[model samples]
Target chain A: MKTRYHIRPRHNIRPQSCIYALLASISVAVFSLPNAAHAAGTLAGTDIQNVASATFDTAAGPVTIQSNTVTIKVDELLDVTVSSTDPGDVITSPGQTSNVQRFRVSNTGNGDEAFALTATVANGGDDFDPSLQQIVIDANGNGVFDAGVDVVYTAGVNEPVIAPDQNITVFVITSTPAGVVDTNRANVSIVAAAVTGTGAPGTSFANAGQGGGNAVVGPTGAQSSASGFLAVQATSVTLNKTATILDPFGGNRPVPGAIVTYSLVATVAGTGLLNNLVITDPIPVGSQYQPASLTLEATALTDAADADAGNFNGTRISVAAGNVPAGQTRTVTFKVLIP
Target chain B: MKLIIRIMMAFATLTGASLAVAATPLQLSSDVFVERTIEGVDGTKTVVLEKPKMVTPGDSLVFVVKYKNVSATTATNFVVTNPLPPAVAFNGTSDGQEIVSIDGGKNWGFLGDLRVAKEDGATRAAQRSDVTHIKWNLNQPLTAGAEGKLIFRGVVK
Candidate 1:
């Protein structure tokens, strides 16, 4: 009975029909199975790597750069990473005689970022003369680089690309002008730029392979600043006086008179050049103003004509022009007569 | 088919709820304070140093005042006035604050309306009042927990 039934069931089902049924079943199974894994893979293409923030030390203090990273998808085509390194704190004393002061510039980022380091000094509003205080660019940040060893670059071209965890040194030098004064403070700014690349080794996978490839990384820039104070001091000023009496009382009673000599000295205790400075010591009430016989001497005076008329004859003696450089002492001598 | 539809609807609802939770606004709070005091040559002198510190004759003295709005509602059209001290000399100023001293702080006018005499006996339009105090005319309402500072400078005698 089973054999008879088996032959009777398939009257006219074509082989082509069977083939079509099999194809339909396969199509249905393929469509029904989850395609989430493929969708996720496509999404990985869109993920981008970026720098969240950057920080560095500067002479002005701790300088920090924030959220300069931009995301880019394959379709978008453009991506940017911004970062900066600051020069740590800087220190300079008043009247630092050293030709150069050194500063260190370092990067403190985990990612291997590249940056251009450039320094700009706003000499405290032209407080420093460029000719007087030479600004020699020492490619190496070390302060001790000799002139022969240092290389100076042109603007924009001068900056060097620094790698992460790397640093350079710069030096500030003072020229040896005879009466150069450093009274104003100077501000120096150091800026850094970040080099663009794929995310640091581990983060690249989060966005799927889509993010890792086809992203253009650009440099992120940052700046650090510092200030220095320069002060010129005047140490001292001295005045000497000589006095002579002419033939008083006309007698041998010890010539009835005596020759008198005195010295007046003034010292500047503070920094800065004193302009239009005048010094006067009036004759005491008991003494008469002597004229036509007083002599004066001064270090800052270029010529005898530079001395004021009152310095010789009047009650007050004045030095027309006086300049006291830092750490220098000046002296003046004068003669007076008692009649 | 019905069971599958129900599961799909439930998943959609959960996703919607999660998205809604992520869109909430963040609330923040802040505070500020301001204080002003006057000290004269003696303890009771009428002169109010723009700032509460001693200044040299030629030095620049800057006076700053700060205030904060702590109330939930913004404070609108607020006004503050500072009288100039007699010993101080007024210089040029920037920003919104005005300088006006008439009859010794008895009346206030815009600095452009005042007349000043120069050392060479020439007269010029006074742009700033010899600053004894500073006043702020706030046009915008200060939001809750919002703080601001006003600054002015003068030469100390």
Candidate 2:
């Protein structure tokens, strides 16, 4: 929002009279005050005026006196705050690439300011150090990482300019090594500082703030940093199979014209997610595969590769058990007839 | 009978007589300052007032109003009224005789005796931000060439 000032013409009129006229005109000007809910408090360059008057009774009559108007301009404050938004240690498998750690940087000052952002994975408090890639901003602000959609950060080029009490979401992308151990953690941190300058609290930069006013460092010192963690987890999926048979007019034995039912169970173990896991079972050499007898956890599956999870390709039965997390299990069953 | 013949709020002009010698008997001036606490080497702190060249929100300010009687006669029933700026909030004053108005000079009383209406149609105690104007009634008469000051405090919003 633009701030408008109504300055009265100052010519032959005295300074007091000019101020009075300016104050009167100011009430009519469309002045858009900064949002009151903003943590930055108030906008810079706001003019505050005060005037007083006295009335007295004299022997001749009653007289009223008007005081000179006093005005003061509000200066700009420089402050920034950064924090990690990750719910917990981001779980990733070994040799995983494109791992991301989310963070948010906020401009907590009373003026518009630019910030220079930097990310590093050289922090030594973790088990393994993940190779740091480039930092990217959530351009759409959806909090999810999208390659080719998010903008990459470059120092001195396209630094984020944030308004007072506004924030931007940033992602620190990294790649874990292939030989890393399970349950290991790596730390990556990002630091954001005001592009104008940074120093001890109360430090002032002349005419470097919005509206050409002096900028003062606030309690934050105009810089802030936050760290996010990435953890490595190992995972594997195992499948077990069992078969049952029944004859036409006798006990359960592998006889001619006997119907055989096969069951396969796939169980995932470890603290990581097993991606694109699939289970397959082949029919016996002397038996004919039954049609429409394939079932996944008691759910029927068609022979064609349709939208369902299980499908048959004339040679074997395949079930796509996509992304199985740790401590989870999946079951698939099919049937065949003895020739 | 003691009758107030005329009351003028403008530049105090007189007509139909010796207009050349027409000047108000009282002079009023206003000034604002920012206060800073300076710590000495002996662990002592002193508050110093300085002209505000650079002020920001949440900063404390002091306003001073000076009035003097410049005529040979005396000024009686003197009352000083100050309208608080929109960008500032009234902090308490050291003077105990000040009266405040919450509703645009419609009602006046001590802060403790004032009540403001809330949006829920209920009345609640008035706070400092509710103050719109401050007034001080000087019952004592000002003799010739006598000057005094009224000081109050405020914080930039």
Candidate 2 residue A294 C-alpha distance from true site, Å: 14
| Candidate with maximal lDDT | 2
- What lDDT tens digits, residue by residue, belong to model 2 across residues A1-339? 211111111111112344334432332121213223446755555567776767777787666666776877667888999999999999877898989899999999877799999998889878888888889998888998899999999889989988777899999899998988678898898999999889998898997876557888989999999999998899867888898897887668888988888989999887877788889888778888899998877889898899998888888999987888889998888889997
**lDDT of the candidates, in the order given:** 0.37, 0.78
Minimal lDDT window, size 10, model 1 chain A: A4-13
Model 1 segments more than 4 A misplaced: A1-99, A110-114, A123-142, A156-158, A172-183, A195-221, A234-258, A262-266, A272-339, B1-157
Encode model 1's per-residue lDDT on A40-89: one tens digit a residue. Answer: 01111221212111122222332222222222222111112222222332
Q: What TM-score would every model get versus the actual structure?
A: 0.29, 0.72
- Chain A alone, model 1, TM-score? 0.37
